[model samples]
Target: MYIESFVEYNYIGEIAGLLLSGLLLFVMLYVRPKKTLLFKYIFNGTILSIVAILFQISIIKVANNPDQYYNKNLFGIQLISFLLVYNGILYCIFSYVNMMSVVRRNQRKEFILMYAVLSIIYVIGIIIEIAASGLYTFTLDGIDIRHFTRYYISAGIVCAVVCFIASALNRREISRITWHAVCLFVPTSLVVLIGQMIYVVKAHYIFSATTYVPIFMIGFLLFHNVPYDELSGTQSIYALDAYLMKNMGKKKIWVVYVILKTLDIENFIKKDIDSLYYGISICRNLENLSPSLRLYKMSDNKFVNILEESDPGKAKLIIQEIRGIFDKSRVDLDVPFNYTIIAGELRSETDTILKVRQFFEFISKRFIDHNSSQFYITKESDYKGFSEHYEISSVIRDIRLRENLDDERIVVYAQPIYSVGTGSFKSAEALMRLKVGDKLISPEVFIPIAESSGAIHMLTCIILNKVCRAIGSFSEYYDFDAISINCSSKELSMENLNRDFMEIIERYDIDPSKIRLEVTETAMFENYERANKNMESLSSEGIQFYLDDFGTGYSSLERVMNCPFKTIKFDKTLLYKSLHDDRMNDILSYMIEVFKKNGFITLIEGVEDESQKTYSVDRGFDYIQGYLYAKPTPIEEVKKFFNRKSSF
Candidate 1:
């Protein structure tokens, strides 16, 4: 076949090679793949290729102008060219093997041995070929070009065979591009070498440019295609998402959110090469427990283990094994890192992918301040309406971002609190409710949002004002004593605590004596002095104060005594425990007596049935507040239904 003249084609190939190789280097540097070490070696390999090309150009210039520069440097140039091109190929092989070692953990020892053997072979080849026979190349016209020597052929063959074997061994473990690299790299390189030999025999200067084409292809094929983290060898978050989505219904998946407890996550990620060692050690420990635990790194300090059909007990054992890694008495690593791991487990059913996503969303918001590193197992029962939770979170985010709540969206619910003995509607506790387009958001969901976003104070004020308006309206029909409103610790902590309470109360022009304020015992303990001051200040204004959820706190009696409470509402947990124990029942009865003697009205919450109500009233409870009377209802509904009941 006829081709273009040697001189023209040679110049085109050289210029084309330079431009393409430079572009490869630029792109590689720009992307900055995770395997920085591998990137460095590839970078060195590229630089060597460029240097070999420059040496060929220099030799061409000197050969043309025979007396312009020293001719003796030609041998040195050839020697250097041989060394660079030879080691450049070796470096490529080294990077591939290293990647295989990282992806498949057990192959590390075999990889190391293979690497040492390859290194020895390359060094011996370079010393024998370059130092003794001096690269075995000849000048074509004026340009010093390259051809395959016995050393080059032998070393390349050994490297290719070993690489092909490594790729075959890790066929399933490595990515498609990596597999393609293993398959294509050796053949392409051998083809280039053969072309170099043919071109040199035909007296052409094309080998230098042609040889680098395969190297550039190898760089693009391997570096960009690697799918796992360069440092940890764990699946990247992106890869995990894709895998989970692809195998959506095929696996019984459980995600274990792993967090490092001892060291700050940012610091752990930023502390140089130690991060790699720590990650490897943790992964090793996890793998030792169960090979099916596919670990993925979620962030700098958080790892996720995706298990197929793994039970909670197995996950717990894996966490325990990881924790044992840091124990000085149990195991010693080369670089012993000070890190402790805590894991949270959530299982996903076939149709519950949305639930897992919602869980991830919830933990993302709360996990930073969570210092406890214990393993927490979460099932569907823990968060039944996962989509609703996600919606609530989005609502919270919107609320926080907007910082203005539509008062129309805020609601007040009231549950009737009746007298245990008379079965009369005595009073009702005003409960806070929020709704978004008819979807009622539980206080359990939005209250935390309020507390976190500094909106609890506003929420309390809204509730108090709404209750006041509702009570004034209800008073025209019913003979109830008062409508009690719940106050949060955030509301009590307000600097204008007294004024805030009175501003709403006085606006409604309601009787202060008829308005009761219920504060949780735990709320008072949050800031005792401030809570006491707020309670005393409100009490001085003729507002009756009740210590709500009394037995739930550590110091119930102390709170009542320090704060001037008119009543102490016993939590139902106390009642439930007293059921099986006669001693507990007696002690509860005695406590009620003691409170009544001290001028404190004792009320028991959670009276669900007639028997509980009878038991409580017989035990000296001044009032009973629970579903035995009614669930929380809107003010309008409460008026119509209760008026009928009273008439009946």
Candidate 2:
């Protein structure tokens, strides 16, 4: 006989059992199982199976006769114990099979049937063990034990076979590492389970070896493969970053950064469970819409879609499809929400992973400040044929890469402001221009960068001081009335704005009356008291203030009335619309009359044609400024412009 005797079996079982128990403890504590349901079942089954083997080892110690021919009570206890442990193992296997099926997007009817059949078999085996039980009482090699039942062992073998087959059929549905781990478990478990049934091995050794191997495999797989987000099943940011880096230089890839407008982030996070379900629901909706669009969570109320389409038009079409999804389902959210998607091509040649991440940051800052719910497409058209597909991200990248801090690259251009009555140039607005080598950077590009970098105030000071010096240097050459410099919201809120203005004017030795500060109504409305105080302080010092782009902000007429602005400038969009529409002209005339009655000078900007200029003059506008007079020119060019016109 090859099997061990009673004393030898006990010695081997205790030594081996203690070592396996330590391994289990080490894996459970160090490897640390994931909180997934499949892992939970596997962990529980492992603990129960190990305990069953321990019970089998201690059976002889508790029995009345160690070498007895029969012990009915011990037999019943061992039969019931092994049967329960086998059933648990089978149940865990079924659970894992179901999990694989769901992940594979397969019909789970087969898994359901398998679970039902296995449950019935386990119930029958338990019944048989309770009603009729006996111990194998032969001292073959002096080892006393019960024969391993065919029913219980066969059930375990069937489960192993089913798990192996499922894994093979759904190979692509599983990760390579995960599939390999499953393969390591299923074959070894099946062979050991069958070997125990046919030959007499120590039951403690068979169960412990089979269960420990699979459990360790599962723990290793879970520890290494990180797929789902901690809060939901969506792909995590870590996965997103990895995928982006892998496809970084791939051609014709596009990513759309989506912002959920009106989403209350604080409230959503407060209700964490609902928020997790909300994220899952969003992923489900995206999957239902287009599985090709892989959604990744970017922020609390933001998501991104990465796709590989050669044509940007196809990406746009996908964006429209996502819009349709949002339209159909937004009302179902617990709170009202809408989406603003910013999309462009993910260029290969010039972009890196860091540049792409910076692009997202730029989009997020713009979305918060604008609070707009419309799709903003920064397509190839904006790049002027630099590439077949260009993105706004490149523009942001250029701005960040710029190292022009000393303001040497900054230039001031003057656009003539003409008197409507005389049609003669008197004042000119100082527009800030940035140049990189010979290329002129658009205000649309640099202004937002300035705002985001917290350098708008510094940029304003630079422009203001430069404009003053330029005008002061040329104040003798031409009888110029005043030069208006644009001020951003940040500049108006500066505590030392009044001092900054006075010091610059004093340094240039220029008359404060010759320099006007131009502000938009939005700036005044955002910080009304600060703006009002600064406006009064500067106006008292002989510097004038003009409300630029009036009627385009959220401020009411009453709020505008309280500001110490001496002039009001109409925005180009409002002027053009009023010029084309008779109803809007009547409203425009009413606006002009209201400002005129309040002793405020009204200037209508964007008068680019004879008809537009005629309308501004006919409406009794105090001043007119647009391409109709002259495009923005340098300070020297402005002097020559008036010198050549003879109107000055």
- Residue-level lDDT tens digits of model 1 in 109-159: 776676677677777766666566455433333323333333454565556
- List clashing residue pairs in candidate 1: none
* CA-RMSD of model 1: 8.7
The number of the candidate with the highest lDDT is 2
Compute each candidate's TM-score over C-alphas: 0.61, 0.60
Q: What does candidate 2's lDDT look like per residue over 64-142, in tens digits?
A: 2445533557556775676676576667666655464334323556666768786887678667654553434434334
Error of 2 at 543 (Å): 6.6
Off by over 4 Å in 2: 1-225, 229-234, 247-351, 354-405, 416-427, 445-483, 488-516, 522-544, 552-555, 572-589, 607-620, 628-630, 635-648
